[model samples]
Target: MFALKMNVLMIITIIMIMSFGIFGETISKTNSETKLIADLLAGYHPKVAPTDNGPVQVKMGFDMSYFDFIDEPKELAIAHGFVYRGWNDHRLQWNEADYNGTRRVNLDRNTVWVPHIQAANSAKVTELLESQVLVFSTGRVRFYQSLQIEFLCDMDLTYFPYDKQSCNIEFGSSLYTTEHINLTASPNRGTNGSRVNSAKDFQITTLDVQRSEKSFRFIAPYSFVDVTYTIGLKRVSSVYRAKLVVPSVLTSFLILATFLLPTASKEKITFCSNMFLCLLLLIAFLHTTVTSTVETVLGQLLAFSLFVDFFATIMAVVSYNIKNRGTSILTRKDYGIMLQDTTMDGDSGMRAEKTLSTKFAWLRYIDVISFIGFSIVFVIGLAAILNQRE
Candidate 1:
């Protein structure tokens, strides 16, 4: 019985030690966590007056190089870069000495309140990688978010192929009024301005960038501050020059070259007809791809080729008629000359035939002159078209 009592005493001692060990482990885990929970609550809920508070200045910027392909069908521009915005709030600032110089803490997005700023014409948000909130020793709170977006651009393709376009990306708050958030084009301030550095080291790709501060109103009486980035994209038309311009010029030259053929050669008409058909085919192909609402330089060149082909066809037909209807002999009196009215000699008929043929020789000269004239016009017009943007 003494041995059993001793065993019971040992069992109680073991149980008490195990309980104390578990309790200490639990305290170690909860002690730091409880403090963090308190910090999260205190950091997010800033003690600002509920009324329409003073302006919250926001600075905004993005890298220019990430402008990828343009989506014409959807009127969207795909861009990828660091997009960060932050504002200062004194209520969330801290005294560094209280936390042993550990004033900043990263929090989940759900735990924080972010300005409801949105891309007015955005289509897709491909990725939302991360959101960071940091508090500084001076009571400054800065927030950051990195994302990829496909935003809308009112694409004007009037100069397509050779067109320059202006595209805009606008961002403004929906819930907050101007009184609560008077935004600035500069979207970062104080602490965030130094750390993220997202907008600072960006290179815009083939765009003339301009930052503007604007204001717009919704159903509410107040106006929201909006920042806009306007970019101009100039077309590089080397492909178009090869596909449209080169062929157009060659086809036009062929139309004029038909003038060198004999007036009545059926081969000349056949060749012009085939060449003209090729031009029409080219125009058809251009129409398929060049669906811009406004006509482009390439379109003009296509139209010009059609006109030249029409004129060449007319000349070809005229040549056939002139050759078929041999020129009629004219009397000497009709040639502004006087001839004696004596017995006609046998040579008269042959002489008259030769004279009539010589008069119609002017047909060849007309063809040559018209060809040169039209070709000169085409070349001059071409130089003007290509140099438009230069």
Candidate 2:
């Protein structure tokens, strides 16, 4: 009986051991082989850092897939791109094939020591998604990082709707001195890639990347390396040309045509005054909405038209006074001659008619002269605007 009990006990112990072994190998992850990876990356920081002359070289480049103007008030531009920072980190390396056949892994950004670069213009980063770390057999690792940037850029909008602008995306290190981290941009510093060609209001005219160095303080050697991306933008003028320019031209034409109205009609003065007021309102609206108080060719022309209309108003008044005075003189002289039995009839007729034609003769041709003068100015203004800086 003792021998039989020993055999039973040994069998039971063996079964328990086998069951635990199978479960431990495949089911229960309490003791995983990945623990080796965890321990290796548990506390790893990049070894490469700034040298004496410069910070450790952190080669920076971007693939700009999306870009748009988000705010007009603050002059803010938003760019969606992949900014990859490359460096040598022997610390984050392992034989992935030997370790569960893993070639890469997704890691937390905080776990890795990344460059702390900022936009020189105080732009902010909006989104920072998941980071990826890839390991090769040679202990080389590459990190893929993404960022969504919203920054204030210097925008030159001189021509406005018919204008082209050059804006910049400048970057530099804020926290680290030049000794700790040297940030450099790639080729054209960066590219808008293929997607920016379809920008709505602005077209990419030039993508220029430039590198410049500056020392912030007045005291010592506190210098920084910066990358500037000058994006040349040409306004798609078809919309403004159709919406504002065409209508303004037509309105100006109407204003010029006002001279055809008979000077005797009371509507001539009122009409010119009303047109001038409307033109002023248009100028004010453009100033408020388009490009501040700066005047455009159209604005200049509008101002000139106002002056022309004011002169027309004066001429209208003068002509009316002349006609009325001529009529009064003729009536008085004719009545007096009738009272004197018509001895001065010939002289009276001659004096009344001759004085009116000779004195006010210029008034008869005033409309033609005004039209010619205005036409010359209008043509000159049109030519100048058409040849406005590109």
Candidate 3:
């Protein structure tokens, strides 16, 4: 029993010693990496570019994660994404053997030379999340930052609801010209295999990356490298078609139906009045729902509705007047002669009815001509609106 107890104590002592040795080794290696990082940044200047001969080539890319919203009135696109920038810094290089095989190290972003990239056409200033700089033993430095950027987009709502828009998000160095820094598009310059949650009204159709140099008219002519990401957005028009277009067309047809009512019916005027009020309400609804900056297909439809309403109103008034009050085209002498003739024949009622029919026959012709004319106008307007689709 004594020997067994002694053996158990020896095993525990050995385990404890091994644990301390491993722990000390880990601390020693961490210290070595810390010392190596300090030595690398000892003579580094964060503000200046790492290259001494030519401009530092920054390979940059964007990976979009979410599309928050697009404000059509403000012409702004807000999105969440990651920005990747990588370059080489010879000063941060070290031999792995000298630092206990430390091939990579993470340093605070402010302690290293980082390219100052910004969106040139941003509607709001973007603040990037704080992140670390990854430095490899081969002098390659990589940086990643998450940001929410609001970019200004020039919108044309001419074909709105069925319209497709192209918005550009341009990124470039804020202070450094092309002579000091050059930006290039990295291989992964898009959504990077991730699903982007876009807005309900819009679907992302295309994403194109273009690199160019733009010259600025400073005291001296300076050119800056620009990387622009063009996003093509197509509107989901199902709601507008159901709510706005279909109703507007039905309202237009109802205005045409106003002419079909009997000339003697008092409901003709009331029907026209109702249609006119409906058109006014539709126009008001359009103004409230759609952007008023440009003329759209719906706008054209409303304008045509006004003309149809005006023509219908005139016809309704004429029909009511002719039906209620006898025509005065013939003079009183002619009527008196007809009355004497009818009295002599003792058929005055029949003759008087025939005279009234002859005078009011023109009302039927007016209704037919107006209906045909307005129908032609409606067909032409619909064709034009349909042809505008791109």
Candidate 4:
């Protein structure tokens, strides 16, 4: 009897311990925390035409890149982390093929493309692989749907103490057009071999030209969080014309004014030189004003300014020399006659006239060159800008 009682007590104690152990294991499994280890990458696909009784289709793809995932040591074990999914938004304007065999543009769904994972696993907890996904839409879509694709990743909390990795998402689309949409290519769909005009849907509205970025640090391990980045570019061709006409006219007039000034007033001649300096400053200011708007084409404007400054300075030098070395016409007309009675004074007048003639001759040539050069530059630059507009 004593031996049997001892055996029964030992069995009861063993059962209780086994029950508690199993309960503890279940609690630990249920409470294991997780972290999201994947980033969003997405883009849209080209539209297709319908054939036979089959529906036409469009496809968009999203690539999910993951990091520090739960180490599924078993090669065949189902590891869960991410999925690919999308949403359909609305139908846009569309038309059918015409008599010429060209179909009208028809976009069926103006929907946003979203990402959800269908299946996922890690080859190695340390290894990162891009899950390439292809999402399809029917050809009934017309006018092409304007859509935004999204990606969401879920992390497994079972793996803790690992840092999340940074991620990037980029997208591009192919062009889709029907012949009816493009009159030049009648009877055929408007599709270009060049990627630029392939899909009418991926064309962004001007309002959507700006890009956006978002980022945040995950403070809690095994917690689910998401970050997004958006990129957009504008399709624009603007004609830029630096108004050389205004500055050129101002500069030309200043150069012309130099000729109107008296030759004898050292100050008057220097004033023409000063006008040239002012032109240089104005030209410099104009170039600087446009530098930010048109960076690549500024070399021509600089060259133009330098050309004006060089000739203006030279004219200033010539004028200064004439004024200092030659007799003033007024001085010669009044003083020469007064001095004519005396041999010494008359000889001086003759010498003065000769010096004035020699010194001012270059002035005439300078005037001609400057006027022609300024006009040429102004007209050429204006003409080039006009041609570009065409």
Candidate 5:
């Protein structure tokens, strides 16, 4: 009886031991998973907030072990992309900060930044590896890290459809036309090591675009705001082209008008001079509008217009001289010698009937030809100027 009782006691003890062991293992696994998730959440803390001037502020954060992919020592890697001082360029707005301390930025303006990370229980990331993934990784040394990024910018709001709406763009007239633009970005931190220190996933979030007109400014039906975000690629900001079509057309016309004026008296000279002066003034206006603005391939085209105008002014002066002076002056030059002799001798009629005609028969023909040639040149120059693409 005693032996049987002991055997029962032993069986109960073994079952209890087995149950305790299973329970302990389950709790350990649960704790490990929770720790893993907590560590990752601690790393990402990107936020977007409002600034005084109505633009949003974006801020981002990242940890030190993140740089191991590029062979950086933990100390150096943690300091990889911090904005310790002022912004490197105009595109980035940085706050004046204590350089020796941790790097931080005010996202109240457009900028990109990175901050130092702490080294504690850092582990290598091994399982997650994909060539297309934003994170860069090397198998040798792995680390668990986090990254945060934000954007502070005004939404490109289109109360008027940017692609379809017709807006009157005035150079003294209103025409229905569509307007569009391209936006781009530049790195503001660790640019020298940009290839290695860039954010794994820099993203824009919390965009707000709104439009309002006077009568019911704040009402929802009358006005609305839209918001959306996605991964974005950064591009260099540059002037794609320079367009000055109206000014160019006006300049060309001024050149042509010089031909229409009479050069028989000082009035014509004064008029041509005034027109020339106005053209010069217009060129100056164009120069002022475009100077320091940017020089593009299109800018070179505008320059060509200026050159054509300069040549036109010279031609105008030359034409004025030809018209005011009689055939006597022009005939002395080698170019006009034959032309004038032909026209003038014909006017004299001195050799009429002697040669079955006059020596000036060709001269009369020359006069007709000169007028026609001048008119043709003027028309062609005007057409070229007016036809330029805006």
Candidate 6:
């Protein structure tokens, strides 16, 4: 039993020794490779372009992770993503076999020549990754920078909640013109495994990338390459319809109901006044919610409501005046009955009664005409609003 225990201990010690030896060798090899990479970059100038003759072609693209938020009033959209850039640096190339088959090395971004690319329409940009890059032995350099970018979006809110908007993000070299650098779109540029199609009140419908060239005059005309990413967004309007449209429509019906009330009753004017206040409140709510300076369907609806309110209130006053005039002439004490005695006073009373009846007929005519006019206008306006959805 003592000899068996001795053998077991010997085996364990041998295994541990072998493991340490392997680990030491790995560490030594890694250090040697790192030294070799350092030696290769000893005389390199990071500010100089890695080319001898023509412009260096940089493959650049964006991989969108998700949408953060969209501020409609501010016309800003925030997105989280990675900016990918690749180029060849011939000075950094080395034989991998001499360094124990080391194919890739990581270097600090500050120690290399990087293109000065920026978003032209961005309000602000925040970096969210470590400042490092991957360098391959074949002279290929790759850089990935995670960024949270806020892009300026010029939105058209004509249709408001049902509106479709297109926002553009422009990327270009800020310092170097086409003479020193050429920008090319990477083939794999676009959304990267992101399932987020909706953000807050908008849904992404389309993403398009395009390349173009623009001329800028510094001392002379210098052309620069620009890559633009267009994002198509459609507003999700279920909430707006419930909060704005449905309520406005109900209030419109209430405005029409003012005309349906008895002309003699004082409630007609009171109803009109209440509806005017309600319409004012709705307008105020709309202004607070959607701070757009453009003309919109909801704005048109509110304006129409005001016009209907004014017309209804005027008609209500006219109706009250007519009722008062009829009452003064035909006393309720006599139950609006004319005397049959053939006298001058009786003739005058008869004529007054006829005039009162004519006035009542005109009041009815005004109510019918105003109601029909407003109803037709409301239907046309609703149709117009619906047609604006695109």
Name the best candidate (by TM-score).
6
- The clash number for model 1 is 9
Candidate 3 residues 89-187, lDDT tens each? 888889999998998999999888899898888878565777899999999999998988998888777776678888888999868888788899998
How much lDDT does candidate 1 score?
0.62
Backbone atom clashes (below 3 Å) for every candidate: 9, 3, 0, 37, 7, 0
Off by over 4 Å in 1: 1-34, 42-53, 72-75, 154-163, 187-221, 325-366, 388-390
Model 5 misplaced stretches (Cα beyond 4 Å): 1-244, 292-390
Residue pairs whose backbone atoms clash in candidate 6 = none
lDDT of each: 0.62, 0.66, 0.80, 0.35, 0.32, 0.80
lDDT of 6 by residue, 214-247 (tens): 8857635668889988887787888788988889
TM-score-superior candidate, 2 or 4 = 2
**Candidate 3 lDDT trough over 10 residues, lowest sum:** 337-346
Of candidate 1, the 10-residue stretch with the lowest lDDT total is 189-198
In Å, residue 348's CA in model 5 sits off its true spot by 11
lDDT of 2 at 199: 61
Across residues 1-390, which tens digit of lDDT does each residue of candidate 5 receive?
999999999999999999998887667655544443343235333232112333222222222122321221121111222211111212222222222121222231212222111212123223232211111111011122233222222221111001011111001001111111111111232222224433332211111122112223344233211112211222111121123445544554454454444433455456556655655565565445333212322233334445544544555465545543533443334332344355556534343323322333443344345445645754664454334221
Question: Model 5 Cα RMSD, Å?
Answer: 21.8
* RMSD of model 1 against the true structure: 9.2
Write down the lDDT that model 3 would get: 0.80
Return the candidate ranking by lDDT, descending. 6, 3, 2, 1, 4, 5
Per-residue lDDT tens digits of candidate 2, residues 358-382? 6666776887788788878777766
When summed lDDT is taken over every stretch of 10 residues in candidate 2, the lowest stretch is 332-341
What is the per-residue lDDT of model 4 for residues 1-390, given as tens digits with 9 covering 90 to 100? 999999999999999999999998666433321100000112222242222233212222222221111121211211112222222222211122211222322122322222221111222222133332222222122122122222322322111111121212322211212211111111212112122221121221211111222222542222221222221212122211225434544554455455455544465556656665765665565445333312322334434555665655566676666655544344535545532335456567677566556657676676666667676776665454333211
lDDT comparing candidate 2 with the true structure: 0.66
Task: List pairs with backbone clashes in candidate 2.
Answer: 49-56, 50-55, 50-56
